[model samples]
Target: MKTYRDYDDLPKIELPYGKEVSISDSTLRDGAQMPGIVMRSKHKVQIYEYLHMIGIEKLETFVYNERDRKAIKLMQDKGYEFPEITGWARANPADIDMVLNVDGIEETGILMSVSDPHIYDKMKLPTREAAQEKYLNALQYAVDHGLRTRAHIEDMTRADNYDFVFPLVEKILEIDPDCTIRICDTIGYGIPFMNVDEPYGIPTIVKYLKNELGAKNIETHCHDDFGLAVANSLAGYWHGANWSNVTYLGIGERAGNAEMEKLLVFLKRRIKGFEKYDLSCLVEFAKFMEKEIGIRIPRNKSVVGQNVFAHESGIHTAGVIKNPFTYEPYPPEIVGGQRNFLIGDSSGIEVLKFKVQETLKEMMDVHIEVDKNDKRLRNIQADIQRLFNEDERVSCISDEEIRAYVKKYFMFNPIVDQELHRREDDESPDNTI
Candidate 1:
């Protein structure tokens, strides 16, 4: 059987997107709106650098505050240019004017609500025509002021595309063909599969915009309310949308948007020539965001989470030790993640031996490696199993705790025991271990 390591060299199903696909970051805007996520200015700057370093093409940030303006200026001054900074704004001249002040932001997203709730209730516009008029005036104002516009169609999944959405897009295009449109599935109501109804099914919506409207530049701003953010974004790309909007760690309002890290990893696999992208900073970037905002990432979350590459099951660990592709889709190191053999309940005897090898290497001054076939290793594995299977409360065992067993059982051998004991007597923290 062909292994995952051999996947790049084999024939695969190519997606329908024309060669190059673009990605945009929305962490500075929508990500900030998530409850309890207040990203500091310095951390925002760091995130921008990380995203640009990983080859993301654009950043959609809020030009709504002083701190956001400051962070944009800082990134501009540093000269990291891959992610062209675009400011988000409401459909008004005053908000677009605020965008003009942010040093390097050339594009802005003007909010255009097409759904019934926003049209009549939230925005309080009497009619859909009036709402379209307001957005068109705002678009013209942005054009007149030397700025590109992205008319963000908010709540589009719940809107009437035939009567309202397309007309508004047509109006925006009439002024400037260069202006792009972002399809915002604001409430995460978009279903990403095919053959569903208009505004509900992802393929139909993308097909309409790409084929019917003949949209010049299209973008996907998806949400994970139904856990299909990435799926919908992929469907958009497959049909012909050029750009996808994402955030670090998928952090945003309620269920959040498509995760930038997940999207990159997905792209790197399907598209050829994407291998040169520098993804070394992605894992650390996720850690930084989690640390800064106190948002906890579920350990099993793909791409940047802690347990994506961690293994402890007996059969799986044995196979992975031989070749990681036996258990993993690809090497964890592809996204700057490391493979680890966790010692716990369900660990194979080989895993115990591997942990012992690691412990002896790290904590000792001498070379004393554990052989897999040694009787001591079997004994140690038996004892470790007893620690878990015998005790009802014990869920998992740590490497440190396993090392405690190794020390007690095998380290008292005649030759190396003398040096280890002498070091232990010295009472240094390293020796204490």
Candidate 2:
């Protein structure tokens, strides 16, 4: 029998994605649009560095203000080839000029609201033709200025693909054959299923863009209003899209976009060419977002959460104590995380003994191996159960409390006491033990 570390041993999905498929981050642009979140120039620069460290190929940002320009300058000064900084703008010369003013930005996303609601209701355009003309003019301006363009077809899931989207995209490709078409599921109305009708079906849309319109590059930018952003993004890639737009922790307007960490982990594990990514920085990135940027990472978040590797229930801990693979899908160290056997009301003697041994080694530089039948370990479990039963305690016991209990039960040992005395004596001026 052979051991399989990842999903390569499982049946694979025959996706139509090319080897050039990659992820583009929107954490600094769309993610910053999340209400109550403010990422200054310095914070944006730090995030750019982290994204580069995680092997992100590209990242887009708003270059509409001095702060945005300063952040771009700082990131460019670092001289990292990956996470190439791009700019976001609306379908107008003024917005494109803002991006043009920022040096080192060779590409910019030109927003084109293709749906009738955005054309008439949002932009107050008289007709669909007017909207198309507006978008084309802006795209041409960007191209003439020597900037690569990405046409963001906003509200695309609800738009008329044949009458409006296909025509506009064809013209966009005519203006610049290299322009990337970014399909935006602005309200998260897109579905991931195949054989679904046009516009709403992500796979259908990507296939149409590649097969019908001859689009050389396509990106998927989905929202999580219905919590299907990642699924829809994958559906687009499975069909033909080359780029998947994402944000850190899915932070963005409304429910947010597809999560970057989640998508990366999935690709690294399931896809063939994605094994080159270094995933060790994922946990560190989550910590940086929480501690430095004041973003609260949900303890139960999929890839980098604090509690993802923690086990408390008796059944789970017992199985994990015998063989970690029995309970965990993958090793914690794969994402730079550690497994923890938390001591709680549901914990059993096995977990208690393990915790005691681990805490002793960490705090006292002593390794005291114990078993489930150890009396001191059983006593500790009994005290915890008593707290839950009598005192109605709900929270797990703290490490300090556990350390104190261990000291009470183990410090009295003759060997331990002698060792402690010897260490104290050696530290004295007399140098005696």
Candidate 3:
């Protein structure tokens, strides 16, 4: 049963999405490649369980060497279900042998470079034919050795589909009709908009693979060099492709791949059948990864970011008090997150009224009714604006500071009075700014 929260009246896509969307997580392979990011074997296994909890469709592990093999074995030994593991390797006999040595990898991706850049610039092949020969030899070797294969066609958008890509795809399918094709948008050069003639258009690429060339289970692997990875992945599904290759935090080479959380949410919004997913675990996973590795998720980062559901502006916060749906697309619980109304210099009277009432009610252990038009609240907002904008120049006014102000003001009149000693602050980049 698909469950929806907050969106009692969801903006449903009445137009039929003809194909089922599949997700393939590549956090271990690609996300680990994020500069200065590292994941030990234990962390990888834990991440796998979390991914499984969120309904990850599949997962990939690179069988590059003995260390990679050992790590893969350790992860598999832990036995958490869902997200069937597949091996990733360049199209070659040696790579195939490495993957085959892994205890339980049932499939592997064949990195077949089909573009002029990959063929000549990267592979240094004299001709497309020569490149195809090398690729075919490896493809034959992988399929013949009892491993199901998928072609990760590197630099796909830059390649000529009619001239070379289609012909090579046809030959690969002729060798094994069940082989899947993973179109690699290497360097993030592809656009997500529809256009068959546009070489780098996602719709065209998926269409040529599925409709023109008769490929099976077409997948997309997009990079975020131009910030279109998620869009391109969605485009693949829109054009009848099945799998979206994603990383936990869009972690990959350079700008990274499509973010698993964002992509899954995108699909859940349009296509049904994700109600049972425990999306709350995603934030836990992201936070754990950030700490285990030394990377910090930016406050403004999408989905799992600390501030994605945080509201500061008075207009938004005031509206949020009325109906969160008026100010937000979905409830924070949709992804198992919390909504916070941050009191900053930009905060308004309405929000101040709400915040003051809530804070005093909790602190005083009483039902505190705050006046929206309270002169004290207006004075507080003005003081906050002055301090936030000019005097202290802080990004936000802390709750303690608000409490102190309220206590001080009440001391002058009748509410309450207390001056608490402030503690020395710890170092954090997010503290001041």
Most accurate candidate by lDDT = 2
Q: List residue ranges in candidate 1 displaced over 4 A.
A: 1-10, 363-373, 414-433
- Residue lDDT tens for model 3, 1-433: 6654457656565214455668899998888788887777777777888888898868888777666676777767768567788988887798889888887888988889888988888888899999899888998999889989888888888888778888898899888788889889988988988754646888888887788778888999999999999999988888888888999888889999988888877666655664545677777777887888766899888888998888889889888988897777667887878888879867788777877877788778887787777767777777777776666775677778778777755435442222221121234445441
Give one digit per residue, the lDDT tens place, for model 1 in 1-433: 7544555555545677655678888888888888987788888888888887888788888777788788888888778767898988899999999999876778888998899999999989899889988989999999999998888999999999988898778878888787778899888889888888777877888788878888878889999999999999988888888888988889999999988778888778666566646777878888888888777989999988889999999898888887777788767777888998887787888777777877877778566766788877887888777777778536667777877877776776545767777878788766565
Residue 184's lDDT in candidate 3 = 92
Task: Write the residue-wise lDDT of candidate 2 on 410-431 in tens digits.
Answer: 7666577678999998889987
RMSD values, in order shown? 6.5, 6.5, 8.9
Better of 1 and 3 by TM-score: 1
Lowest-scoring 10 consecutive residues by lDDT in candidate 1? 3-12
Quality of model 2 by C-alpha lDDT: 0.88
Better model by TM-score, 2 or 3? 2
What are the TM-scores, per candidate, against the unseen true structure? 0.91, 0.91, 0.90
Where model 2 places Cα greater than 4 Å from the true spot, the runs are 1-14, 413-433
Model 2, backbone clash pairs (residues 3+ apart or across chains), number: 0
TM-score of 2: 0.91
